[model samples]
Target chain A: MTIASEPADGYAVRSRILNFLKYGANSNPADPRVPFYRHPIFVRVAHWTNVIVLTVMLMSGLQIFNAHSALYWGYQSDFNHPLLSMVAMQNDDGSLKGVTQIGPWQFDTTGWLGASQVNGQWAVRGFPAWATIPGPQWLALGRLWHFFFAWLFVANGAIFASLAVYRGHFRRDLKPKVSDITGLPAEIAHHAKLQFPKGEAAKTYNGIQRLTYFTVIFIIGPLIVLTGLTMSPTLDSAFPFLPWLFGGRQSARTIHFLCAFSFVLFFIVHIVMVVLSGTWNNVRAMITGTYEIEQAGGRHG
Target chain B: MADGATRRGFLMRSFAGVATLALAGCDSISQQPWLDPLLRSAEALTMRVQRLFAGNHALAQEFTKADIAPMFRANGTLDPGTQEYRAHAQKNFADWRITVSGLVEHPLSLSMDQLRKLPARTQITRHDCVEGWSCIGEWTGAPLAHILALAQPKDEARYAVFYCADPMSDSNGDGINDSDFYYESLDMVEATHPQTLLAYKLNGQDLDIAHGAPVRVRAERQLGYKQPKYVKDIVLVDSLDKISGGRGGYWEDQGYNWWGGI
Candidate 1:
C-alpha cells in the first residue's frame, strides 16, 4: 500500500512538478489531490492561540528584563561579578556607549542592547525600545503585559497538554519510532538538500521535526515556566524547593532568559523550515487543518 | 536549487513583514480602553493563587548570616531630605514620632525609643526588588503583629498602610517639599504574619539614611516595593479606595500591580 508499491499510477511526478510551478494563492492541488487532515480543529486553535500568547509573553518579558539589565547566579546579586550585564558606559570626556558584558568578555552593543536611542535621544536601556512591549521604559506597564499574558500562556499550555495526552496525539504523532533514530543520518542528508518527504511520507512529521517539537514542548517549555515561578517571592515562600532546584533565584532568572532566547531561536528555524518546505501548504495545514499531500492517501509506512 | 532558494528568500521576507505588522498592531492596541482591564485580570489571578498557596502564616525563607550580602543596595529614596526630616535626622531621630491612626481603636503616637522596646524579631532574608534583582540582609524590628496589637486596629480594618517621609512627586506648584509622599500597604493577613516587621536596624546597626533611616517595613513574603521606608505613620483602613490615586501604593498608583507577591 506504500507509495513505492503503487508507483505506476499512485502519483504523477510530472503533474507534481507543474503544480509546484503553478503555486497558486491557495495551495490546493487541482486534480489527484490528497487532502490530508494533518492538524485537528483543537490543535489548530491551540497552535494559533499560542502564536499570540508566546509573542506577547516574549516581548513583555523583554520589557521586564530591561528594568534590571543584569544577570546574577546566586541567592542574591554580587553586583561585582555578574554572569551577564548590559550597561551604558561613558567614554572619557563625553558620550554614552552601550556595553554588553558576558563574564569577562565585553561587546559594544550600541543602538541595541544596553544603550539605545529612545524618542530620538541616546538613552540607557537593556533591550531596544522596539523589542519591548508598550514601546517605552515603563516597568509598570511591562509587568502588566507580562503577567497578563503569562496567565494565558500557562492556561493554554495546560489545556493543550492535557488534551494532547488524553487524545493520544502525543503518542501517535509526536512520539518518535526506532526507525526514526536509525534513519537520523540519512534524514539529515535529505533535509540538508532541502528535500522534504513527499506523497505518502508527508502524512506525519519527519523524525527531526518530531524530536524538535518534543524537546520544546516537554523540556524547554516546562523549564521556562518553573524558572519563572521561582522568581516570585510569595511562591518562593510556598515552595522553597523551587529555588533549591534551580540553584537560586538569580540563577533561575539567567536560565529563564536563556530559555526565552531559545524559543526565539526555535521560532526562526521553524519559520525558515516552513518557508523552505512549502509556505502556503504548511500555513494552510495549521490554519485550516487540510494539508494537500503530493499523492492520494494510499498507505503510510 | 537556485529557483527554490530565491523563492525561499521571498517567503522569508514576506513572513518577516507579516510578523512586524502583527507586532505593530499589538503595540497600538496595548493602551486601548477595552483591553486594559482584561490585562489586569492576571494580576488578580496571580495574587489570589499565590495567597491561596502561601496563605498568611507561611514564612519567607530565613537564611543564615553567611547568606547576607556584603552591601545591601539601599533602593528607592535614599533620604526624605525635607527640612523636618533633616532636623529629625540631625537629632539622631530622638524626637521623631510615628503615629498609628485611621481605623484603629486607639490612636497613639510612639517615638523611636518606644518602638525599639516593643516585641522584637530578627531574621536574615532576601529582598526581591520589582526590577528583577535581590539582596539579602539581616533586619531587626518589632513584629508588625505586635505593633497592630498595641494599636488595636478596629474590627473593620482590612489594610495597614505605612506612610513614609520620602516625597515621591512635586504635587504643589510652590515646589518645595509639599508633595505626595512614599507609601505602601499590606493586607491584615500579611500585617499579622510573624515575619512582617517595622524594622529599624540592618546588620546589627541603626539603619543609615540611605536605607530608610529611623524606620522601614520588612514584609518578608512580598517584593521590596510592598515594604515602604522612612516611616512616619500607620493607617488602618477597610479599603484602599480613598488613598492617593487610590491603587494602594505609590508604584501601584503608577500602574504597577497592587499585588506585590509576584
Candidate 2:
C-alpha cells in the first residue's frame, strides 16, 4: 500500500516529524501500539548465512586476483595491453614499487593495492595481507578457500532466489510498483536529510530500498554469478556463448572484479543505514522476525 | 526506544556472538577434524555442478595457429632426470615404449614410432595451469580414443591413469630411485574425449625433452596438471582408490581436488 493511503492522522504526522529529528530510531511516537511482522524466518537465516559466504568469497576472490593481477578485454593477455593491473615493478635498489594502471591512467599504489610489505619483505600482491584468505601468497590454498565457499554461496543464493519467487517475498516486500518511481526525488531528498518515515510508513520498506533490493537481487546478483562461471576453462567450452557474450574470458574477469566492488559498496551502505536507522531494531527484526514501529506519542510497541 | 537498556543488551550480545562466529571461521580451528567431511561434501557438490555443465563430448575451445603462445612453458617437470629417462632422451626415445595394460583385452606395448602411426589429431588449445597462467600451443598426437581402441579396454575400465617419468620429490637431491613419481588419471569421459591425446609433437616439431617428450597426455578439458607430462604407461582401472596416495594424481594427493575441471 502507498504511504498516501494512510489515514492522515495527526499522530502519524507528528510521529514522522519526531522520527526525522531522531534519525529514524523508534522514538517519540504518537501511535506506538502496533508491531509489524517484517522479516521471514527463512530470510533471516539466509541473510546471516550470506554474511559468512560473501566474506569468504570476496576475501578468497582477492587472493585469486593476486595470482594474475591483470585484466584484459579479450580472450588472451600478452602484457601488451591491459584494462587494469595491480602489480609493482622491482627497482634497481631492490625496493618494490606498486602501481595500478587503468588504461592510460596510472596511480602509484605502493604499500596498498598492488604492493605491500609482508613479514618485513616487500612483495607485489593484490589487495593486501589483511584482505586475503589464508593471509599469504598461496594461490593453491586461495583457490581451495574460494571454491569451498563458492559452493555455499551458490547454494544459499539458489535457496534465496527460489524462496523469493515461490514464496512471494519479492511481491510482498522487494517488488516496486509504478508509484515507487514517482516519489524517487523526494525519497532521495529525505534520505539526504537523514529524515525517515515513521508510524505505518516505517512498517514497510520505502521506495528507494525496494528499488535497491530489486536491483541487487535480480540484476547484480545473477550477473556476478554468470560472470564468475565465465572464467572457468571447462565452462568456456561447455557454454561457449558465455565468453563470447562477455566479449572474452578476460573481459568476464574485469566485470567480475567490478561487480565485487559494487557488492562491497552495497555492503558498506547497508551496514551504515542499518546502524543509523536503528541497529537493535533492525537486527532484532532480522533475527526474531518482528519489528517495533514508532508513532508520534514517544512510545514503541 | 524506552526499552533502551534491554535493546542495548541484546544488541551488544548479538554483536559479540556474530564477532565470535566470524573470528572462529578465520582461525585455524575451522579446520578441525570433524569439518573435513563437511568440506568434502561441499566439494562434491561443486564437482557435480561442474560435470553437469561440462557434458562428456563437448570439446574445449580450440585456437588458431596465430593464437599460439611464443613459448609454451613446460612446467611441473622440466626434465625427468632419472637415468632411464636420460637414456631414452639420448637415443631420441627410439626404444621408449608406452605400455597400455590393466582392464584391457590386449595389453599393448607400443613404441614411440608405433604411436605416431595411429590416427592423429592436431588442435591448438589453451593450456590452463592450476597456478593461474595459460598458454596456447598446437599439439599433434594420436587421439586417446583411437589408442585405447588398440588395447580394447574391458567393460570394467572406468578410469585411465597416465604414468609419468618425473620424480616429483626426492629428499636425497638425487632424482634416481625416488619414491614420489608423478601420475594423473581421468574418468572415461575425459579419457576418451576427442581432444584427449598422447601428444608426441609440439609446435610442428618433435616433442622436446623439456616437454613430455616421447609422449605427454593432453586432456584439454582439465587444468595443465591433469595432462601429465613424461608419460610412460597407461593403466585402465575401475577406480582411483587403489592408486598411490588413493587420490587420483600426485597433486590431488597433495590437496588438490580429484576432479580438475576448470
Highest DockQ scorer = 1
Q: In terms of lDDT, which candidate is strongest?
A: 1
Model 2 chain B: weakest 10-residue lDDT segment is B22-31
Candidate 2, residue B23: lDDT: 69
Q: Write the per-residue lDDT of candidate 1 for residues A76-146, one digit (tens) a residue.
A: 99899999999998879667899999999999998999899977988899998888897788888888888
Candidate 2 per-residue C-alpha lDDT over B1-262 given as tens digits, one digit per residue, 9 for 90 to 100: 7699899999999999988866654436435666445555666777677778888888888889988878776787888888888998999999999999999999999999899898889999878777555678999999999889889999999999988898888778654446589999998889999999999999999999888887999988888889998899999999899899998999988867777775
TM-score of candidate 2's chain B against its reference? 0.89
Pairs with backbone N, CA or C atoms under 3 Å apart (clashes), candidate 1 = none
Q: Give the per-residue lDDT of model 2 (tens digit) for A25-87.
A: 434434453567888888999999998889889988888889888877766555667778888
Model 1: what TM-score? 0.89
- DockQ of predictions, in order shown: 0.71, 0.44
The whole-model C-alpha lDDT of candidate 2 against the native structure comes to 0.82
Worst 10-residue lDDT window for candidate 1 chain A reads A22-31
Off by over 4 Å in 2: A1-34, A91-95, A117-124, A178-183, A296-301, B1-25, B69-74, B81-87, B173-179, B209-211
